[model samples]
Target chain A: EAGVTQFPSHSVIEKGQTVTLRCDPISGHDNLYWYRRVMGKEIKFLLHFVKESKQDESGMPNNRFLAERTGGTYSTLKVQPAELEDSGVYFCASSPYRTGPTGETQYFGPGTRLLVL
Target chain B: AQTVTQSQPEMSVQEAETVTLSCTYDTSESDYYLFWYKQPPSRQMILVIRQEAYKQQNATENRFSVNFQKAAKSFSLKISDSQLGDAAMYFCAYRSASGGSEKLVFGKGTKLTVNP
Candidate 1:
């Protein structure tokens, strides 16, 4: 099975520009998540989606950031009027929806490196 | 809220030697999961090993193993016979086993270098 894949492995844009990152999860996986890692910092969770509905979005940093999963398949994270602090590596992960002693293991994609100048 | 910490910013080891990466986490939940992920330069992050809090026994995968101390709230990764390919940024992460929250909490990460 193919792993999670992301589009535009690297993006460079000016501050105040809008950028959209896309992620295609593994086939048949219902759980999708987005995380970001700033330079020299830990990876922080942004949001999660189960199918077409959002499961949790408390981690979202601000109103400028928005994420959507359409048709319960792929996800997109949009940063409008992106600021310099928004530059970082954005990672998307997915896992099968299963409940058991062994919790769901997330598979990550090659993160998209965004640089806002 | 739970937090994960990796004290070591960077570490080095000679090829064929063993190295351990330290991690400490703070969590009140009894049932949870811990993970170690390896991210090589310009590559996707991959899982190295994971340990369920309920399991006393540590988790091992080939040359990679974890020293999980539940009481001490510690989870460390030990790489035996370290290869040059093992050089990467190692991250320690924690996840709650609850039904609603499935997001992972990650540490700042430790960069490992294997000298040949």
Candidate 2:
């Protein structure tokens, strides 16, 4: 019954460095999503995973960002050569499989705060 | 494209009092969902309440409730018996059923301060 959890609650790295943020979805959850809130900006969706397959990644900002979910249990978002603008709080959410037309409520994790110096 | 608007950037309410946070959204589709999420200083996004467009009755969760107006494309949250714990950044969100991808469009949040 645990909620989604994230790793490295806070991270600091120099510009052009690499940082990896991890997330562990709740047990039995089939859908996982990644979102972020940059400086003074609203939270925005990054990508989604259904099981081991990436259901959608249209929200991904650019090529420098990479996300992966192995074994459908956990997820990782990696930023290479991070930019100053990449500094923000990254959130991970998970939900059970949707069986009906009703929208499923997603439970969020404590976000990972990344600072690109 | 769908967008959510929260006109009030900040609001405050006395403890045990009631406060309403307004939100307006624009969308072409009729079937959609609206949500109110609270992010306290801890920065965890918590679901407050949600409203389905096809349902006429509003959604209520304990002290949290929503006033959903389909015609106005407006969804406002009313928190009754506001407590110090209620002080947080509340975001109004919109999700479309026809978008194929389950993505939430969020508005710039409104910070709520509950006075004890």
Model 1 residue runs over 4 Å out of place are A100-102
Task: Let me know the DockQ for model 2.
Answer: 0.64
Q: Considering every candidate listed, which one attains the maximal DockQ?
A: 1
- Model 2 compared with the native: what TM-score? 0.97
Clash list (residue pairs), candidate 2: none
RMSD of 2: 1.1
The CAPRI quality class of candidate 2 comes to: medium
lDDT of 1 by residue, B39-87 (tens): 9998999998999999999999999999999999999999999999999
User: A1-117 in candidate 1: lDDT tens per residue?
Assistant: 899999989999999999999999999999999999999899999999989899899999999999999899999999998999999999999999876535778999999999999
**Candidate 2 structure quality by residue, lDDT tens digits, B1-116:** 88999999999999999999999999989998899999999868899898889999999999999999999999999999999999999999988876487878889899999998
C-alpha TM-score for every candidate: 0.98, 0.97
Can you write out model 2's per-residue Cα lDDT over A1-117, one digit (the tens) per residue? 788899999999999999999999999999999999997788899998999899889989999999999899999999998999999999999988785545778889989999999
